[model samples]
Target: MLIALISLFLAGSSGGSAAGSLTAAGVLALVVVFSAAATLAVSFLLSKTLLRGESSAFTLELPPYRVPRIGQVIVRSVLDRTLHVLGRAAAVAAPWGLAVYALANISAGGETLLSWFCSWLDPAARLIGLDGVILAAFVLGLPANELVIPIMLMAYTAGGCLTEISSYAALSEVLSGNGWTAMTAVSVVLFTLMHSPCSTTLLTIKKETGSIGWTAAAAVIPTAAGIGLLAVLNCIFG
Candidate 1:
């Protein structure tokens, strides 16, 4: 019930996709898997903290489940958080986008030094499960998460005009021009999906946690996790 309501709120507020077409079992399976993992993770951490390296116990709560106020929930999740994140994202993205354009365009000898730097990092980047172009994407994408895909597409162009990807064939050819393979695609997706959010998300974290430490942790933790995972994958599949 709560999940359905939350989904409805997200959809109504921001046109966020709701799981409308899924079979009942599929949705339940997703909720069950996600809930189990989150529950176990919290339980493990709390146990370690409370046990002092000894025995630990856990108690589960199952509320009788009463109807919740629609207005109250909408005010909290929809009107409040959606606006907070969106507003902060726009604030961060505007200046950050301009900065990124400057950094990416300001050139040496009629071409950007950025591509030169990407070349310099190529070997090291390859060893760590990426390429020179992917390294470039990472640097240029720091301003906002949304730019990652665009920068990556520009990298694929390799100093040429960016093209609209109309089909899988065109996508493959572009990637192929940059020496991309399945491994590269997999690694890129993994890294981008797991990496840090835009500056707005950072601000949101600060507000949500009311602590700079937790906000910083929120930023650093995912980054470290992504890098570590990529490093391991690179080592194994490299």
Candidate 2:
């Protein structure tokens, strides 16, 4: 239930979508309706199919809704811990995000290096509907996937002038001006799905694996897959 709710909220928050313009309260209301419908369907299935025990066996306890004895304290505890962990992660990712902004914005030799890289990569990059520097920005964004689109947008826009993005429509216009098409959209969606988790996720991976080998592979394997898929698509469409 929790995961489903969070996923729906994130999907709703995707700024590129016209549907994302829906109010948060409106989205939550939809979520509640969906949840109730799903619950009813599951209950009916269990009663008609699973309860017979011909193919499978299971037991479910639907407890009556009731306030817990320590509901107030429990709610406070959950909120505090959730904020603490997420707050620490925000602190860790903040400077890295800022540094990314600088790298995308900074110019060398009176021209942004990112633009030059994109031009160089254009020969092959165009096949995948993206430029090289945009690809590189996405790679760097592995440390924090949340920033991928923003960095790529910045790299593509400002011609490396590094403008502050205050609106999604502005970002959309910039990409449209830069020759973006449907193919580019497909490649980016794939890349985002397969790229390494952000810096916080990397930290979690390291802690879980307790070995540099696994941690590195966690990053490399997915990246390899994404790039390989892009290359294959390029060859077919190039």
Q: Which candidate is the best by lDDT?
A: 1
lDDT of 1 by residue, 44-75 (tens): 76567643576555689998988998989899
What overall lDDT goes with each candidate model?
Answer: 0.63, 0.61
Per-residue error (Å), model 2, residue 155: 2.0
- lDDT digits (tens) for residues 1-238 of candidate 2: 2222222333344633555544444545664675467447655755686355555556899999887669787787778867756765787667766766566567787666566565667676665656776676666565555556566666766444334566545655776676655466556655655556676666677777798876787677666656777778867874
For residue 183, model 2's alpha carbon misses the true position, in angstroms, by 1.2
Off by over 4 Å in 2: 1-84, 113-129, 159-171
Candidate 1 regions with alpha-carbon error over 4 angstroms:
1-83, 159-164
